[model samples]
Every structure is written in structure tokens, then in C-alpha cells.
Target: MHIPRWAIPAAVVAASGMLLTGCGKVPPGQQANVGVGAPQAVPDPARQDPSAAPSQSAAPTVLRVAEAARLGKVVTDAEGRTLYRFDKDTARPPASTCLDSCANTWPPVTAPKGRIQVDGVDRNLIGKTKRPDGLWQVTLGGWPLYRYAEDDGPGDVKGQGVGGSWFAAAPDGKKAGGEQQEQDDGDGNGGGRNRWAGWTVVKVRQHPRLGMIVTDGEGRVMYRFDGDRPRVSNCDGQCAKTWPIVKFTNWKKLKTEGVERSRIGFIERKDGSCQLTINGRPMYYFAGDRRPGDANGQGARNAWWVVSPRGEKITG
Candidate 1:
């Protein structure tokens, strides 16, 4: 029998773990870009970095509703720049904690006249709060709004997970982006009673070096093997032992955003196991990875690597 290029011979499987040990180590500078669940660095607006502060433009008096490809419905300024909410801010009391440098980097959405106009949003939820700078900032559903300086134009979400504290604001004053809990359906399929249901099977994970990559429901990084074609499982026996297949119980219930549904399907392994495929390539998890967001398997032996939402391999 001819083994696929991705499949390792049984002899190599016995020592694969030892040979692949410590292969996941990313360089110091490269690791700095990986952002897991939240952002670690608090953005300092006072640093005076031109890129860190919004341009000097007229304050937007009207807020509008815009659709983000991955974030659904989000609130934007008159110019269409995405507005964000700080995780540290309290909604009940309606306060603005972003001051000085923080304010420079994320300029508060000021409503100078205390009266603001809104489009496609509930007018009742629109309100105003006093900032430390003595400016009246706009508030939606009791949450203050701000624009990210890093965003060059409208619809930029560069601050979405910055410092793990900032996120795009929803029309209802909720965080526009982040992971949600997956509910288990009685069937083996992972679906909850909520609207998320099948859509929760796949999600986005931010890596310091890899930007945004696709992850399974448990947040484990998903990988694609180069040797296999679409709907084919070339990794078997010892090969499968090192890189286990990623399988889903119900294909119809598998929901995904930012990914093409036509590229998703399954393949039968030699051992009679069903493995998941994206864009005709089989997906798997590294046996060496023990926790969520682990991409230790990336660049392994110049063959394994994590995949982007668009089904491209993240080699770097």
C-alpha cells in the first residue's frame, strides 16, 4: 500500500514524540504578537505615537449601525469607524475610566451638546455621561463609546482585543467580539438551546505571531496537513497518533462565519473514523498540545501548521 506524503511510517511514530519535542518554541519578538483570550498591555494614549491616536477631526454627533463580517451588528461613528467598549468600564453607574494617555489612544466619542443623533439604534438607549476631561461623551445602554486610534478608517477593528480589555461595541451596548460558551445538545452534536447553536462549532483565536486563526469549540488550534488532498485522510496509524483527526458529529449542525461552508466536509479514516476537512484538506490537533490555544504543532517538520479562517495555512 502507498502511504500518503503526510503519513509517517509506523517506525517513525514510535520516536515521533521525542523528535518533535520543543518544536513549538516561538522567538521572543514573534511571541509578542500572539493575543490569546484578552489583551495583556494597557494602551497608553499619552505616549504621543501618531498611530496610537485618532486624527483631529470633528466629533461625530450621529452614531449608526453597521454590519461586520465576523462581528455581526456593531455601532459606528458618523464616519463609519467602529466604536468600542472597555471591559473595565461599569454599565450600571455609567462612568468613563479612560483618561489622559488612555484617552489619547482611544478618544472618547464626545457629544459636545449633550444631545446626539442616532441611526438604526434604539433612541431610548442613547444617553450621555461626564468624562474627567469635562466633556460629555456618548453612551449607549449605559456604556460609554470610544474610537480606536489605530483604526485608520471606518470598520477598522484593530482594537477589538487590544489589552484584552477593548472590544467593538454592539448596538445594545455589548461587546461586539469574543468567544462564547458552547452548549451541548443531547445528540453528540455540540449545539446549545441558544441562537448560537451550530455556529459555535468553530471560532477565532488570536496568536501573538499568527494573528487570527481558526480554532475548535474548545479553543484548541486546528491544523492542516499539506500532503493530503480534499476529503482524504493520509495520516493513519502512527501518523494519526501524533496528529489526531478533528471530527464533528453532525455536518448540518456545523455553523461557521468567515469560512466557506462548501469547503467544509468529512473523510473516512482507514480505521473507520470520520475526520473534518476544510477546503479539501483534513484538519487535526497536535498530540503534543495539551491546552487550548496551543500551536506547538505549527511548522512541525516543515509540514504541519495552523490554518486561517479563510482556509490558508499560517506558516509563519
Candidate 2:
């Protein structure tokens, strides 16, 4: 239940690749009391398509279940655009942590001032909470709903696991992806979050901008700090807040692809937590890198550099 030091809300996510498929049924015994709301036209200025104008009609905001490639039954808006929930947000009290700039990227699915239509989703689980801006945002199973701005149209779920927090919403207001439910592994990270079977724990990706960069399990590019000696990490405190260390507890759980298994190791931090390392260099996740394929931490301050599959620093 603890939020990380560098925790940001959400962003566009790459699709999770796995062969698993099945219909996700809502768990039983979950019931809440809330009034129905009629849908109205809510403007989303951050929409990717500038040519797509806002709807002027008074149609109800339709919430329904749809099938995703690997994520199975997921919640989508009337446009078929995938809706997501933030892991940092709370469902027990029906609160949202995504705000300001985060809200700009992941727009809250604002329920119209009046009744919403539902399919597959339990209407009893549907409700609304007043955002700080005084807008009535839609909520499901007490968890607020949101839409990824980068998701172009129907069937586009480009925001599946950004920042290790964002995920496609299931009909029952739980994290979607069929049988792959979020389970805590005692690290407070909810186990391999959004990671599916055959997903690599460490791998080499041919980044279009950085080329042949090392990526963590979720495909977020990893970095190495020049300030640290081999097997030691100097990036802690506020430095760690900006570049969170790659943490792991079990060695057997670390999987790799295109990277040598011998190169993968770990170092105990001053905090008593084990941080994943590659070829003796400590690994990190840049807080600025919102999603997979992002190498925003590359050449940062001329000290931080993205690592390559060979466990060498990537200069370009």
C-alpha cells in the first residue's frame, strides 16, 4: 500500500504480449449503493486526434466490456477506447491520485450530469465522485475510471502498464488481463504487475531512438549511474526519487532474453532492499520515462546512461 518516492500517475502503455485468453468474470458479493447518472457531452482537449471534434449530442456515456489481445475482457468507453485504472489510486475510499499533468495524459472518464449505460459491468458498482475541480468523474466498484490520451480509437489499449501503475480496467473494477490478477509478492509491488507469462524480466530491445538498449521486465529502458562503483549504488535519497532502483527479492524470478543470465545479479542497498544489477552495475528506472520504449534517462547529466544487452553503457 506504500507509494514509491518517484510515483507519477499514468501514461500510454505498450500492449502486453501473451497467449493467455479467457472471459474475466466479476467476483461475487461486491455491492454498493449509488444513483444512476445520465451521460452528457464532456470535452477532452488532450485527445490525440485534433480533427475529431467533441460530441454535441446528449448521448449517454456507454461503459462496456470488450476483448483485448492479451488482456482479455476490459472496460471501454462508447468509442471503444480502452479505460484504465491507476494502481496508485485507492478503490476502498474511491479516491484518485492522477491529477494536473497526470490528468492531462490520462483524462478522467467524466460521467455526464445525468444516467450512464452499462453492459457486462455491474450497474450497482457504478458511481461518481466529485473531483477537486468539482467535476463528477465516473467510478466503478469505487475505483475511478480514465481514458488514455494516446489511445487513438476503439481497440487501442496503448496504456496498459505505464509507470508500473496504469492498467486496463476489468468489468468488476479490478485490474484486467483475464486470469492475471494483481497479487502481492510481499514487496508491496503487487507481484510482477501487469507482467504475463513468458514476459522477460530483463531483455534487450531495439529502441528506435537509442538502439539495442537494456529494458526491464515491463520493457521500460534501464539505466546505469557513472557515480557508482561496481556492485555499489550512489543514487539514493532524492537521487533515487528521480531514478528509482530496480528492485528484486527472488533470484529465480529474474528472467532474461538477449541478455546473458550470468550478467544479471543484485546488490543489497543501505535500506536492506536488494537492487537488481547487470554486470556489477546497479540498474534504475527513470521516473520521467512514462512507458515502454522510452529512453528519457539516456545521457542524463552526462552521468546516467542506458545500458546495452552486453551490459555496457549505450552512449547514443
Candidate 3:
């Protein structure tokens, strides 16, 4: 898939353990980049660089962050796997480099063309895109849907904050470009200066099913996956037969209790119709996500991970 310069900063607390969508959101202004010091890249585990601390340099003019804890939610697959969020993201770029043979390592969430519910999230701004293969891809507010190839096994977060251009999607599930969260007053360990380094702007999103899933007593989405990261996506044309798009014709018609207005949104496609993009990525009914809460796609790739609304992993 192609990466779009304008991506979603959707921080997710995935209820499932799988990291497919587990692979995670948005482009914030360049000023508040995650690291104040130079960002070093290390591919192999042996070469993993130690995480750098934020410098006490001048703060960025605008610091985009996840919504406060109160407004956040969480998601989990049926089997009780945990999820987390990626702290980084880039501008709107729709092309995803993980495809073809690489896609075997990470499967894309697939769904057919349709209309999306636009009850709360700015539905008017939702849009869609068409790939070179003529396949219609959904866009939230404009951010395209994609899967991460590096995410192996369910709940693996290898894709978290890659290139500082990507991030783990939030529970809200919609790719929204709303205002950034305000900085906390208590920043410094001592007296006056704000501990800008410790404060992180969790990129988040709002998907259609985030807060709408059938939950357990403790409110966990159940996820079950039989593979690991770097594994091949077993579902293909025919394999995808069982898992379909959980589509709805009109947002005005459905009646969901306790669901937030901002949590719901729409995505438009090339067919002139619209679909749903959770938090900002496209939503797909996993062919194997059977039994209403099953997350069969977790761990297919190492980059996949889930998140909570408050920016934590979704656990029982």
C-alpha cells in the first residue's frame, strides 16, 4: 500500500493481543518531534539503540497529544491478549511499504465498498482513495487504512513509532486532526519548569468498533491468534471469505448506548460511497475474527500492538 504524508495520530488501546492493526497514527507539527536529541535507528535486536531522553531544549510551539484519560477507551480481542500504542507519527502519506511478499508477514484489514456512520466525528470531512490495482481503500477524514508487515505474533509492537512517522492507534479509532491535548501543570520534579521531556503526546485514533464491542465483566475485547509475528497471513481471497466488513448504511439509524459521539465517524471510497475508519485507519471484519469478539489477526506481524483510550495496553 502507498503511504500518505498526512497520516492519523490515532493512539489505540487494542483489546486484542494481535499487532496487525496492532502495527499502528498521525502527523503533528514538526516542532514536537518525539526526541529532542538525535534519533538513532537500529534494525537488528543486537543493534537496538538505547532510548534517548528528551532534552531540556525549547519546547515545540504546538504539542499534539492524546485525549485525556476520561474521554479515552480500550479494546481487546476475545482471548485476552494485551495491546499498546506507538508514540510517533508523520504527515499525511498514504503509501505503505509493506506489501506483496511483505504483506504475507502482515495482512491488511479488508472490507468491501460501502457507506459509513457519521454521527459524531466530522463525517463531512471523511474521504477515500484508489490504489493502482483498482482496489478501493477507505480513508478517515482522509487517512488511508493499512496493515503492518513487521508485526509478528499477536500483540507484537515492532512497528511502534517507526521512523517516527508511524504510531500505535488509540482506542477512539478515528484518524482525527483535532486540537492537541493541553500540557499538565505538574511537569517538573522540583518547582517551576514543566518536565517537557517526560510528557509525551500519544498519537491516537477512533475506529468504529473501539467502544462498541461486546465486553467482558472487566471490559476487555477478546482476541485469539494462532500465529506469531513475521508469520504469513493465512487469509487470502478465499480465506477472507468468512471475515467481512461490519458495515452499516446510516449512522442516523443505529442506536448505541454509552458510545461517544466523537468515537463514531465515516470514510469515503472511490465508489462515491463511504465506509468506517476507526480512529483514522480503515475498519475490517476479520474473516477469522469469529464469535463477535475473536481477534484472529494478532501477532501475524511483529509490529502489531493494541492500546487503551488512556494510552495503555488493554488487558483483563
Candidate number of the best TM-score: 1
* lDDT of candidate 2 over 1-316, digit per residue (tens): 9743222121111122111011111112211101100011133343344433222133237899999999899999887889998765655446565655577788888866568889888999998877655557788887789988899899988999886678999998888875344432212223555554432277666687777777764667899999988766888799999999887444335555456554666655555566777877889999999877788888989999999877899887
lDDT comparing candidate 1 with the true structure: 0.66
Candidate 1 pairs with clashing backbones? 33-208, 34-207, 34-208, 38-164, 39-163, 39-164, 45-101, 46-101, 230-280
The list of candidate 2 runs beyond 4 A from truth reads 1-60, 178-316
| Residue range 195-221, candidate 1, lDDT tens digits | 433332555556778987877756678
- Which candidate do you rate higher for lDDT, 1 or 2? 2
The lDDT values for all models are: 0.66, 0.67, 0.29
The candidate that wins on lDDT is 2
lDDT of 3 at 132: 28
Overall local distance difference test of candidate 3: 0.29
Worst 10 residues of 3 by lDDT: 30-39
RMSD list, candidates in order: 16.0, 19.6, 23.8
CA deviation > 4 Å runs, candidate 1: 1-200
Q: Candidate 3 regions off by >4 Å?
A: 1-97, 117-121, 148-158, 162-164, 170-316
Task: For model 3, give the RMSD to the true fold.
Answer: 23.8
Between 2 and 3, whose TM-score is larger? Answer: 2
lDDT of 2 at 268: 50
Model 1 compared with the native: what TM-score?
Answer: 0.43
